[model samples]
Each structure stands twice: as structure tokens, then as C-alpha cells.
Target: MTDTCVVVPTIREWECVRDYVANAREYGHLDRLFFVLVTEDFCDTDGMREMLEEEGVEGRVFDGEAREQWYEARGIEEYGDLIPAASHAETSFGLLYLWAHERFDFGVFIDDDTLPHDTDYFGQHYRNLEHTGETLAVESDERWVNVLYRNVEEHGLYPRGYPYSAMDEEVGETTEQVDHVVASQGLWTNVPDLDAVRILMDGDLQGQAQTRTTREDYGEDFVAATGNYLTVCSMNLAFRREVVPAFYQLPMDDNPWDVGRFDDIWSGVFLKRAADLMGHHVYNGTPLCEHNKAPRSTFGDLNNEVPALELNEHVWHIADDAGEDAESYAEAFGAMADALVADDTDYINDEFLTFVGEHMNRWLNCLDAIETGEPLAEPTPADD
Candidate 1:
């Protein structure tokens, strides 16, 4: 079908999955588009089937681990000479279509955390896919969101863009130039542009560490529209369906390449790299996001005589103790993750074996990293 496919890849975010599918339903292209939840089968799966059928969505369980791992192994072969290390899930999402591109046409891969800001723009994305068939990435027109990419280069663990000097207490600069931006709500149309995307994911960038964008104290002034490395992010990268079968074959894991890139950052690198080469393209719709909740205020450092860049509306994150600031505390909430996965007592044997094997594999990888790659044993595992 030369129609649009809204694929929301979710994990434990059941409460939000239906709403995301519903957002795609809002688009007039409901018939022309398919909204699916590519997720693991949860215990509460009983109502999903009827709910999806009732809502006009196609719910499918992706072999999350298989999809991620298969692609990694293939990537190990395809780009082995270059990738040396396997790309994580983020870098791996671009490969999801590795074995299934023939089934659909245009596609938008959104995460469970994001939803279309409004229906008008959501519909516009479908139209863009129908028209250009090019990757459609979203970038908010607001200055705060735009300024977050301050300094296109000198990025550290965060903002990994331009020179750090570019950032001050004030908003950096504005070019009026808006290509596909890679942020929290990516918009892509990967049809004929599949190969380019594969190369992009191979580049370096991130999203899970997005809170770091705020941490870096980056503003627009530091951002310089230069080359591929400067390509924003895929918070909202959409592609044509034909592109999937080519890249979706990778194996999923805590760390695919065995290298330590966060899942979101790995995906961001892929889109950023591709756009670096593909000439700039603007999305047709307005911002899919209006006001991104800022959990805490930013350190405007304005008193230094520099203006305090108002980071209104854009997503902001802050460091806080348990319950003092947020509900999604990784440390505090980690127990829930354990609880969620723990309920599966039936797989005790399999789970235990997998755990032992995984640890052994990590120790071996560590040996390999030291013997081969320069930085040996630096990147620690997530749970570690």
C-alpha cells in the first residue's frame, strides 16, 4: 500500500500506546494509513486486540530482541569494516524494515513517549509522504527548541555539536533555515532514501540523553548549519515503508554492537548522518509539538549580563531525588521494571540462562574491546 504507516514502538508504556495510535487515527488519512503498535505481548493484551480493531489500528508484536539482534548481526556483516562495533537499538531502528519493506509504502516511526502535537500537522505528514516520498523530520518553529541545538559542532556528552564557546548565557543565532530537525518528535519518510538513512544511523548522535541537551547549557548561537554531523535529530523522523525491509534485520539487545550507545542516541546518529549528505528538506506541517513539559527551569546564567534564554515549551529535564521531581525515576522505578519482567516466572530457566550467557558475553566483549578498540572497558552496561 502506497499509504502511511504509523508505527509506535513501545515497551511497558501500554497506557500511552492506544493514545498514540489514536493520534494517527485523527489524520484524515485514516483509511490510507495504518496505525500499529510494534510491541512485546503484555499480560494485559486481552483488550488490545478488540481495542485496536475497534480503533482501526493494526497491532503487531515485533520480535523486539530478534529484530534488534538480527539487524546487528547483518550490520556486522554489511558495515563490519566500518561499524567495527554493532549499533544499538536507536541506530538499529533504521534497520527494522530489513525483512519487510515490500508490505507498506510511507511510514512514520514514533516512540511511546511522543504524540502528534495536533491533528492538522499529523495529517500534513501523510500528505507529504504521498507527495514527496522523502524523509520528513519535524523541528519546532519556536526559538527555545531551535536554540537547544546551539553550536552545531563542539558537542560534549551533550549538544555534541559545534564549539562550546558558541554557547553563552543568551540564545545563540538563527539561520531561518529549517531542514529536517532530529528532536523528541521525529518525522521521516524513508522511501527511496533508505540507503542514506542506513549511513546516517552509522553516524554519532543521541536522544535518550536528550536531557543532556539542556545539561550542556547549549543555545542556538553555538549552532552552525554546517554538514551531516550537524543534522539535528530524528525525534520525529519519518520514512516511506519500502525502506524497512532493508534495515530491520538487526538483532536487538541491551547493546548491539556491544558498544555502549544509548538506544535513542544510536537512532539519532543514523538520521543525522543521512541528512548531512541529502540536501536540506523542510517538513510541510507546523510543529507536531506545542509545549514540551519542562520538569525544571534552566540555568539561564543571565545575570552574567547575557540574556537568559527562555526555554519555554520545549522538553526540559532536571536532576532530582526520588519523588521530589518526577515519577519516572530510573533508579527508584527500576524496581517496577524488575516487577514487570519478574511476573514472567514461567521463563525462570530461560531468563536465568540468558542472564548468565549475557554476562559471559560481556566479559568476552570487554577482552575484545581491550585487544581491538582503543578505549577498553570504559562504557559500562546500563544495569551496572
Candidate 2:
């Protein structure tokens, strides 16, 4: 059975769950829709779960505490602990941890604030996966799939983690250099993921503005994105289950960086490089989503810009260098982790390595448990 899983990590964004799932159903039936809400000690988990149940949406709601419990039970408390104490960070790890255990053939990740604008949003992602597989099998090594992200309400507005510096307008690279991409991202409307600095600097559109790149103009086509301009967000992206490993959110650090910042930037960079190494391609697709973002804290967003500027300049190089081995995606992932650790910058630290090691080990164990019908090792319960 083909199971499609969508994972949404939220802290207080509970209000939108019902509507998000409602729009999801318009595209296809989901096998499991996970809403992992992070709270202190898994507090109010039942309340939250009941709230979603009241909405009549079919999904499981687990808390941060339940995640810790799962990790301890699996004898990987250290690995789980490596996930930062921040709720946003915990939320990211919780989603990946669930993927490590769950069974599914396809997966989609969307931020709670993002809503599907088209009925075919889910189907388009799945179709791209199919196209990606066929392209890789029969087409060529250079072909890969990456969804497009078209931002609404603003022409130059891009997502927070987007490598706007690498836009084709500046690089002038043709599609031939970067062809056949499978994993792509869709764009958003209503406060598209642009930087605060740019927004303030431009001082344009206090409320709303017309967005660029509609499906009616471009149609449902998987256009080849220039190699220089590839970036994606958890806001609205999908991938095959096999590529889930590549989408693992990088561990958040205790440094000065703001919470929930730069994680997707790292993911986008790493996934693109991993796909390239595996002979898969990535793109920016045409399916659009409306991102009704909440009001922003200007100060926090400004602080986030510091790391964004540094990383946007160099992260891709790290990914590009790591993928030089041309190893399989799984092998390249470990290699990439090792490279990230070797760099040992404040962003990529000892804790991130531990997280990576545990994740890699768990992935193998997960496969073993499924193949041999043997359960994974767990911590011994204390005597009552």
C-alpha cells in the first residue's frame, strides 16, 4: 500500500491544523498526517490531541515529551538530547524521528501557516516523484527532481533560506547544466519568505501585493531551475519516502542564531548536493501556497540575518565539496555529516555529529527490524 505522510511541526500554531488538513484532502488521501506539537514535558498533549480530534482530522498528535520517551526507550537518549531544548528545534527533530520509525512511500512537509492554493498541489509533488524516478532510470545521471516555490504578493520576495544571491539573473547558467530535477518546492503568497531587512528597506505593500509566477501562465510544468538558484523550505515541499533521509533537518545549535532559523537553509543545501551525488536533480516547481504568516518580531528576525548572510555565501560550497565523492545518497549523507563536523564551526558542532551518527544508525536498525522481524534495542525499564 502506498502511504502518503505529511509532517507538520508546530508550537502554538494549532488553529490552522484543521484547515490545512482539509486542503490536503482535496489533493489525495493521506495515510498518516502527523502534527507533532512541542510543549514543555509533553504537557497538555491530550488537550492538543483532543482539539485536533474535535476538528475531525485523521492524524496523530505527539508531544515533545513523548519524543523523549521514544528516544530513551530506544536507548538513544543522548541522540534525543542533542536536539536543542528550544521548542522549534525539538519540533524539527521530532518530525525526523517519526520518519525514522514510520512506514510510508511518499511524504510531504508543510509549515502550519502555509495553505494549498491549488487542488493538485499534493498530486503534483507525487507526479514529480514519478517523473524523477523515470528520469533517473532511463534519462541520465544529470536529471533530478526538485519542486518550485513561487512566492505570492511580491515579485522579488523569496523564502528566508532561499539563496537569492544565486539567482539565474546573476549566474546566467542554462538548464542544460542543471537538468531533470525531482525534489522541488512551491512558492507562497501573503508575506512570502523574504528577509526583514529587504521588506523594511523596500517599504512596499503594507498589507498585500500581487505575486508573480502563476500556474495559469506557466501551467503545471516541471521547469528546469538553474543550478545556482536552488533552495527549499519545509513550508511547502514534498519528496519520496526514499529521499526522506536527505530532508533531515540539520541540528540546531546553542549559538547566537535565532530558533527555527537556518535549519531549512542547511536542509536545502544538503538535499540538493545529496541529490546531485545520487544522480538525482532538483528544481523549483509551479504549485503555489498561501502563507498567512503571523506578525513578526522585527528584532529577532534581524538577528537571524547575521547567520543567513554568512551561510548563504558558503553553505553550498560545503555541500558541493562533500558530494565530490559521487557516492550514493546514503553514503554521501554520512560523508556530508562528517564534513560538517570536520568544519566544526559554531553552526555545525559536536552535538550535530552525535545527532547524525544516531540518525544513521537508527536508519539501518529500522531497516533491519523490518527485514528480520526483530525489534530494535530499547532501554531497560526501571523496576516498580
Candidate 3:
């Protein structure tokens, strides 16, 4: 009757995972959605499971040591010393273990750090998945950025382009929203049984995301599977179990993985390459888990960020471009924008160097405006 499942991976995410499961159950589709948590630290498995059961939400936790074996099988023992603590890749690998060895039609991958502030978030994904595609997620207002394409390699953006395929040749007409949807926070559907997951497990990182994708054999419909850029914050992402492959441990024997930051980015790159071969679309539609405690990314800087972000949760009626319209805020995204446009670098490492936290909140704000005409605008001083 139901086609979607909720997959939460845990390492030290006991608290977050507990909150995520409870929120998912409150959404009304808990019966249809399977909740599975993979723990990297097996010792915590029983505690995490007990915690879930105590909360009236049932879940399954896979072996933590087996996860390590998955890595050894792939030759990643070298990075035993370097994998960053609490990195997306590390958390992701735990989730990947669940995906590779599990059975499901569609799976939603949500990070353990977030606690859904609203229950409707998951219900939306349930509806979107029924429509079409392997992935669906929130827009994050990624389309608004003019320089999005430039940061593809740097951000690991993906076969991810905005405005959603301007031309639709199926009937010689383009659609309004988008066909290439990347499901985060839950949609995760439309995987062709064994398509996205079957052959990709039990290999190195490249093998799980790269080699397996390119090396696989699919009908002309898909050559490989790709993931979302901003949608894949390692916090909330949902996809048909098959639309994406289960992740493999970093091949430490071949090369040590820094796992410092960019693991999820690299995951996007691998999936994008696969999707590109098949000529499929990737997008965001379903709402994922958001950090109510945090506003922006710790690794981001604010530039061209509408400036009035802190004043209001929504923005509308912006009546100026640059110049005095832009106040003197040193941490503004404009600095990053300048580096992106003026310099010869794909990433904006402006000499002005400012700290950008909550990197996607700015984009999420833009998306909220489009979804609801809520007033997200900041008024300019008429006297000035």
C-alpha cells in the first residue's frame, strides 16, 4: 500500500535520531514509511533501538561492526586514522550500509542532526513520491542564484541545473515546476526495483558512487544515478533505494580520505555523473529536516544574501539592485559573488575572507517565498 521508507543513519546521533523518528510518526504516514537506522557504533545500537521503541516509534538498527567490515571489503582501512569526526561521509556511510543491504521501494535519507519542526514535512514527501522520479526535495531557492553553475565542481552541485529543463520534448512542451526532482526529507521513490542500488555496494567510495555507476548496465533510460546539491546537506535527503547506490567506505588502502568536509559533495558528484550518462533530471521538492537551532551553515559566508535575512523569515517586494540597496555588511555574500564573477576561480575564495555559516538558509528563504507569498522582503530607507 505504501511505497516510501524513512532511513536514518546514526553514529553518535542518538538524540537526533530519536527526535527524527518521533516526528516522522506524528506525520500520519508512519505506517507506510519504514524507519531504519544504521549505527556506525554498534555498541549504541540497543540504546538507540530502545530509545525509539520507548518513544512508541519502531525502528531497525543494523550492525555497527559489519559496517566496518564493509569498508575492509572495499580496502578503506587506510583512512582509519583520518576520517573526520562527525563528517557527512562518515554519517552517510552508515546510511549507505542500510541502503545497500536492505529491501525497499523508495527510501528517504535524513541526517541525524535535524529534528523536524513540523510533521507536515514528511507527508508532503509521501505525495511527491507518488507523482514520479526517484528523488524529490525542497527547492532551497537554488534556482535564483545566477552563479550556481560556476560552483558545480566546488559545491559538488550535481547534474543539478536550475529553472528545470526549459524545454520538454516529450510532447514538444516545457513544464512549469520541474521533472528532475531530488527528494530530500523524504519523497525517495520511483527506483526501478534493483536499479539504483543493486550492483553498487561492497566497493570503495569511487566504486560505490563512481565505478559502480559508470560500470553498471541500465536501459537507455539511465546510465547512472546522481544526488542533489543543496538538497544533500547530509541532513535530509530521500531517494528511491535504487535511484542511488548505497555508499562504500573510503578506500583507505588506495588513499586516505580526509573526510574533513566535502564527503557529501563528492557523493553528489558521483551520482550526478551517473545521472548525466542516462540524461535524467535532478531537483528538490520535498521538505527535509531543518535545524531549528541553527540558521546558516558553519562553513558558509553571507554575500548578496538580501541583507534583511535576520529581520524577517520571509522576503518580498525588493525594489533595488546593488548600489545603496546593498548596505555595508562585511559578511555579505556579495564578497563571494565578486570572487565568483570577477576572478578566474570556480569557487569564491575572496581575499576578503569572511565566515559564512548556515550556507543554505539564504536559498531556503528564497524557496519559502516562492512556495508561499509570505512577506520575506526588507524595506529600504526612503529618507536615505
Candidate 4:
């Protein structure tokens, strides 16, 4: 049996955690799985720990203080500082800690609001990551695969961060099979991961009745062709431990810019670029999760997404150009960061780009610190 851990970052109450534990116990491989819950300062960590203990769930809840201690003990305290206290991207810290400490064979990520479908959720993810059998190899002429098309019955719907310009491009599919699956992205049954604009357009603004979108069965799982990229949602995602180095979810909150909500999408961009260069495969499908999305102001989400819209159009292309000459995931990531820093774009200013690029390199340094078991050297101040 492969060692697996589920990483969840949540600000919700204990009942949310309790439901996930129950779902895992009932539909997942509970015995083979461990849970790493990263909670906000407001959460009751003690109560959460007690609930896990009473439920016989092998898990630990990390509040802000505990996470700081974990990073400090590993000598990667600087990396911990990069993650904001109340952001969704804080899950990146949990993932790094798992890689550097627990060393699980596989890591699965899910949102606190999602529940596993009645099927064998963890088993399917494990099988996909393990590449148990042959699966379809697909590519798009547009260079981007809208995975939403495969998972949902609805037409004209795209996942968050999908390039608006590429929606009309032609798709070329292949029946070839590949065995190098390193990542598996499970689909969601209810309240699929759509952008705020889409949510508003579909619901209140358009005056349409709200509805849930369920996963449509697409016989067999498929992997992206060597050159194609897929939009990866951190929720319902599973990847082998080897990819963790290149899989740092980009931080969106607490930056000196207006951008937010592109963390996982951009992370996927870099991961896919690196995976393509390294001869690994990313699988899409199976192990559907029921996403009972929590209520939030759609207008606020729209505001957060506004600045990212333009960045989304160009970042994937930038990653592609930067990664073409790279030989490894780390190298590809480094190249991408350099490209971002060098880019002259009208939408994203130089100051924000420099900040983002600096953090990208900082993430790499964190991984190096873990591998070398040494503290990261202080970054030199830039000449003004």
C-alpha cells in the first residue's frame, strides 16, 4: 500500500473537518491515509485535535504557531514567511512540510467544503498516480486542454484561468496510451470550479436559476500529450511525491498587488510545463468529489479575479517559452521565474513582477534547504 496524506487548509468550523473525516472513513482508504489540516488563527485547534482523536483519525491540525514551529525546526523559516496567514495558498506550506518531513508517497489535496463521492475516492487517485493501466493520450492544437469539456455535459464552460483567446481553437485528440502518469486531477460533481465572472453570469446577472453540475462519465481516463497543458485545480488533486519540488502553489494574497485566485492555476502551468519537459504525464478524470461550495459574495470574488484575467492570458505562454530549454523541473521553474522577471507587460507592472519572481526563486531555495538539511542563506538586497 502506498502512503498517502490529504492536505486541507480551512477557516471553517470543526464540523467541516468532522465531515471530511467521516467521508474518508466511509468512502476512502482511511487506514492508508493521513490528514494534514492547516487552520487559520480563529479555528479551535484543540477541539479539532480532540475530534480527530475521538474519531480515530490519524491526523494533525496545524494552527499558525504550529506551522511556524514546523518550518523553524526544518530550518526553512524564510519559506514559511512567504505564505500569508489567512490565504488559501497557505496549503503550499503544508505540502512542503509533508515533502520535507513525512515523505509520503502521494499527496492529495481537497477543499474543506468538498466531500468524496460514494466511490473509492482515494483508490482511484492512487491507481491513476500509479498508472495501473493504459489511458488515452490527448493533445489540443490550441496547446491548452479545457478539462472541463471532458468532465461536464455542459458546452461552452471553461475552468478558471483558461485563456479566453484559446477557447475557439481546434482540438486534436489521440488514442495513444501512455504509462507515465505522475499527477491525477479528480473532477467535481457539484458547483464545479468556475471563475467568479462565470458564476455571476450564470446565476444572478443572467437571471438564470442556479444549478449544480455533475460529472459526466467519459469511459476511460486520459493524460495530456507531452506538449499540452491542463488547468489543474488544487482541490481534488493528487500527485506523486517527486513533483512537489515544482508544485509550489503560487502565493496570491498579501502581495503588494491587486491579484488573487490564480495560485493553483499558475502552479499547474508550471507543473505541466515541467512535466512535459521531464517526460511525465498528468491524468484527468475519476474520483469525483461533491463540491458543496460555501456561500461567498460573488462580487468580491469577481474583484479578486479582475487583475488575474490579463495575467492568465500571457503567463502560460511565458512558462512555455521559458521551459523549452530546461532539462529538469527545478531548472524549468527557475527559467520560468527569470522569464517573469524579465517580461515587459502592460497589465502587470515591474514591481509586482519582481516580487513574484523573487518568491518563485525563494520557493526553490526552500526545497533546496529541505534536500540539503541546511538553512537558506539570506537573500541579498537589490541595488537600488
Candidate 5:
């Protein structure tokens, strides 16, 4: 049996967390499944742990302080800096820490607002990761595959972070190929993951309507070819342990520009580029979940996303081009980071790029420390 850990980052009430735990227990592999709940700094860690204990669920709840303590005890305080407080990306820390210490075979990430359907959510992801037969491969003229295409009831909707330039490109054609699967992306019913702009324009902003449900017969899991990319929403995602080092989930919400919410999309782009170069595959469609999306200000979301809209168009392309010669996930990611820092694009912010690049390298270093079971050395003043 494959050991798996489910990581959820939430700021919701205990009732929401309890419901997700119950659903996972009902539909997922209970014995092999461990849960990791990451909450904001303001959330009560002790209360959360007590609730989980009362529910008899095997898991740990981490807030900012707990995360810091974990790193401090290991003498790797610098690593904790990679994950910001009050961000969905906190699960990245949970996943990486577990992989480095507890040693799970796979990590599954879901939003707190989501619940499992009658399907075997965890089992399907495990099977997809273990699949070795010929799987569907998509070839697109636009070098991108909107994974949401034909999979959702909505006709014109695309997944968040999908480039607007490629919105009109037909899905092209599908063929069959054999490859090793590294990541599996599941679909969601009720509410599909979309950018704020889309939600403002066409979505049921109040969550009062069920519009973006997944189509029943959406066909088998599919992957884009080496030169193409897919929009990977982290909310219903699972991936092999080997992919963790490449999937940092890019930290957000604490930056100066107020730009946020592209963390998963950008992380997915990096992972896909690295997976392509490393000769691994990422599959989409299976183990669907119901996203009972929590209500939020759509306009606020738009404000957070505005700055990255233009950057999204060209950033993944930069990753693809930068990672072409890489042979490993780490190398591919590092190459992309270097490219981001070196980019002279007008819309790209130099300071932000520098921060991102530095953190990318720092993330790799943290992985290295975990692999070696040694605390990362404190940086010298000059190094800082």
C-alpha cells in the first residue's frame, strides 16, 4: 500500500475541517492516509489539535509559530522563511517537511472548501501515479492545453492562469503514449477554479449556483506533450514524492505589490516544464471533488490578480525555454529561477524577480538539507 499524506491549508472554522476529515475517511484510504492541516497565524493550533484528537483523526495542525518551531528545532530557521504566513502555499511546507522526514509515497492537496464525492479520491490518484500503460496525450497548436476544455459544463471557461492568448485555440488532437506519471490533477464540481476576472465576468460569484460541474464522461486522463503546458490548480492535486522538490507552490500574499493567487499556477508551470525535461508525465481527470467554495470578494480577488495577468502570458514560456536543456527537476527549476532573474521584460519587476529567484534556490537548498538529514548552515552576512 502506498503511504499518502493529505495537506490542506485553511482559515475556516473547525466544522469545515471536520467535514473534510469525515469525507476523506469515508472515500479515501483511511489506514494509509495521514492529514496535515495548515492554518493562518491567528488560528488556534492547540484547539485544532484537540478537535482532531477528539475526532480520532491521525494528523497534525500547523500554524505559523508551529512551523517556525519545527524549523528552529532543526536549526534551519531559514527554510521557514520560504512559506509565508496567511497564504495557501503553507501546504508546500507541510508536504516538503513530511517528505524529508516522515517519508510518504505521495502528497494530495485539496482546498478546505472541497469535499470528496462517492469516488475513491485517494485511490484514483494512487492508481494514476502507478499507471504505466498508454495514456492520452494532447497536441495543441497553441502549445497549451486548457485541462478544463470539454471537462466542465461551462463552454467558455478556462482554468485560472490559462493564458488569454491561447483561449481560442482548439484543443487540437489526442493520441496515445506511454510515460511515467509523476503528478495527477483531479477535477472539481460545484465551482471550478477560475481567476477573479473570469469570476467577475461570468461566474456565480456568490456560490449560490452550481455552474462549473465536471462532465460525467470526460474521457480518460490526459497529458500535454513536452512543448505544451497545462493549467494545474493545486486545490485537487496529487503528486509523487519525487516531484516535491520541484513543486514549491510559490509563496504569495506577503509580497509588496499585493499580487497574489498565481502561486499554484506558476508552481504547476515549473513542475510541468521540469517533468517534461525529466521524462515524467502529469495526468489530469479522475478522483473528482465537490468544491463548495467559500464566499469571498470577487473584486478583491481581481485586485490581487491584476498585476500577474500580463506576467502570466510570458512567464511559463520563459520557464519552458529556460528548462529545455535541464535533465533533472532541481536543475530545471534552478534554470527557470535564473531566467526569471535575468529577464529584461518590461512588465517584470526586478526586485520581485530577485526575491523569487533567491527563494527558489533557497527552496532547493532546504530540500538538500532534508535529504541529507542535516540542518542547513546559517548564511554568512556576505551570502545574505
Candidate 6:
């Protein structure tokens, strides 16, 4: 039987973590739930593992050792420690570790606080992948699918990376659809999904009120949007094994941007652009889950999200321009990364491209090393 490797990143949200696993178990989705507790330097890995065992959740805990060793094997020991404990984006590295070492057809990501309200949560995501390219007639094609989620107040929420501009836009009304899709996103409920900006603007600390949301529900349907603005959060997102490497490139320490915040958003944009070039679609909307947001300050969220409100649009524009005539997703993605570094003065000195280049090379080396059970050749340093 095929199974999904469920990835979760956390610092100290233990109870929520327990509930997350319990919900899946209750729904009978725990059989293959590889509940990874991606903790930081300060978090107690032993305690975290104990908690999971107590809750009967099966999985692994990553605390940078494997990542460090992998990078060291590639002769970039200094870069191995680049993943920051201050930000949660290091979780991407943890997931990449699993992808390199384990065998799984799909990888599923869910926040520690999110829970499955229905018994078929995993099945829903599985079916989406199974039918990714199914076309009912000559005019129809299914690519990416998003599972919807509601928050504590019964208000529909958009994923963190979801574009506010595209929130009101229908799938094919103003946007264009691609022939295939590389990834799918699931939405949240109660807190329904909202970016840090929206959460800040609304000032709903309690998440107690149900605000009317756009494109909130598409009953039992897998939908895709044609606009450049649509994006997905890692909270309830899944990708095919082949697509993981494309989105796996996380911003370890690239700055002027928050390490924790925009990693997934920018990666989603990169993946979307690549998917589009590959004749694939990126979609969002059903297999609903619940996002009972924990209480936090709007100011804190604003601090983290304000940059993306401007940069995400800029990122997509760069990807689109760079993607013209691109032969493959890798080519398109590389060109986009280069352009991102070129256009922005702040990014020029950031060594963003160099890090990305090294990261990708290291990933390739790591994958090869894992398969052969031997250390791979050293990675060639990218041009400075």
C-alpha cells in the first residue's frame, strides 16, 4: 500500500502536536503518518519524541544533525549549519532529509495545530494525486487540488501564501490554466485561511468571528486558478515525489526577507512558475481541514508578512519574465532565481543565488550518496 510522509515543524506546541496526530489516528489516517517533529536547537528532541510515543504517533524527529552531516559530506560544512533555529523554514531541510533517505510516493505537510475533521483526510489528498491529470471530456483536465479548511469561528481562511488579489478571481475567468499541475494545496477553517497581513488587518485574536471569505468552498471539487497571484501554504499542502525537489529549495539564511515567513511563499511561486512551464497547473480548494489558530499578536504577524505583500508579486513577475521559452522546470526555476538576485539591489550582496546553487547541488549529491550508500563527489562551488 502507498503511504504519505506527513511532515510537521514545531518549537513548543506539544498539545497541538498531539491533537494533530490524534485527529489523523481518529480518522484512520495514522497508518502511514510519518509524523516528523522538526524541532529547533533549543527544543527538547527527546521530550518531543517521548510525547509522540505517548500519543501513539509514529515518525521521526530531526534536529539538524542529519542535515549537517549531509552538507558536510558535500564539503560545505560551514553551509551545513546555515539552517537557523530562529526560523521554522529549516523544516524544509528536515523534509528534504526524508526525501533523500526514505521511500514514499507522496509527502504531506500539516501544521501542528491543524486537525482532520473528516475521517478521509488522507484519502482525499491521495485521490487528488491519483486523478491529477484526469480529463472527463476533451475540454476538461484535473491537475492540482487544494483541500479546504475552516478555523475555530467557522470563517473560511485562505492559505498563508494565497494571493489576496486572486482570492476573488475564479479558476478560469481571468487567469489561465495549464495542462498539468505539480502540487496541490488544502485550505483551513475556523480561522479559515488568511495571510499574516489579513490576520493583522482583521485583528481577530480570538478567531471567534466568521468573516465572509471569497472562493472559500468548491464542494467536492478539485479546482485550479489561472492567475499569477494564487499560492498555497505549507500548512496543508502536498506534492508528488518528483515535484518535491523543485519546492524543496528553502531560503536558509537569505535576507532582507524573514527566514521563517516567505520561504514557502516564494518557493510556491517558483514551483507555480515551473509547473506552468512544464505544462502543469498548481491548484487549491477541498478535502477540508481545521486550522484552530493559536493566539498571537497581529503586530508579530505583520512584522513577518509585510514583505511578501510586495515581494510575492515581484517574485511572480520575475518568474514569468524568466520563464519565457524555458525548456524545463529546472531551467525556468534557475533563470528565475538568477533574475531575482539581479533585479534587487538588496539581494545582490546576499549571495542568494550562490546559496541556492550550492543547496541544489548538495541535494543532488545527498540523493546519490543515499542510493549508493557511499559519500558522493564534492559539489562544485557556484560562481560568485
Clashes of each: 79, 29, 36, 0, 0, 29
Candidate 6 achieves a global lDDT of: 0.57
Highest TM-score scorer: 5
Candidate 2 lDDT by residue in tens digits, 77-189: 65565456653444445445445545555566677676777567766666666553222111112222222222222355544555554443322223333334556566665
Model 3 misplacement above 4 A? 1-5, 40-43, 66-87, 91-102, 132-182, 185-231, 246-259, 285-288, 292-384
Better of 5 and 6 by TM-score: 5
Question: Could you tell which candidate, 4 or 5, scores higher by TM-score?
Answer: 5
Question: Which digits, one per residue and each the tens of the lDDT, describe model 5 over residues 172-230?
Answer: 65665646899999987777788887776774565223346564636667777767898
Q: How far in Å is the alpha carbon of 77 misplaced in model 6?
A: 3.2
Question: Which candidate, 3 or 6, would have the higher lDDT against the true structure?
Answer: 6
Off by over 4 Å in 6: 1-3, 15-31, 54-58, 64-78, 132-181, 205-220, 226-229, 252-260, 325-328, 344-384
- How much is 7 displaced in model 3, in angstroms? 3.3
Model 5, residue 273: displacement in angstroms?
0.4
Q: Using TM-score as the measure, name the better of candidate 2 and candidate 5.
A: 5
User: Which residue runs of candidate 5 sit more than 4 Å off their true CA positions?
Assistant: 13-28, 151-154, 203-210, 348-350, 374-384
Give RMSD (Å) of candidate 6 vs. truth. 6.9
- lDDT pick, better of 3 and 4: 4
Comparing candidate 1 with candidate 3, which one achieves the higher lDDT?
A: 3
In candidate 1, residue 339 scores what lDDT? Answer: 30
Once superposed on the true structure, which residue ranges of model 1 sit more than 4 Å away at CA? 41-43, 63-99, 127-235, 241-253, 256-261, 280-285, 290-384
Each model's lDDT: 0.32, 0.54, 0.36, 0.76, 0.77, 0.57
TM-score of each: 0.44, 0.74, 0.46, 0.90, 0.91, 0.75
Q: What is every candidate's alpha-carbon RMSD to the true fold?
A: 17.9, 6.1, 20.9, 5.5, 4.8, 6.9
The ten-residue window of minimal lDDT in model 2 covers 136-145
For residues 212-268, write the lDDT of model 6, one tens digit per residue: 443344443444443244456787787776665457546644454453366677777
For model 2, what is the alpha-carbon lDDT of residue 369? 40
**What does candidate 4's lDDT look like per residue over 104-134, in tens digits?**
7889888888887767777788888877455
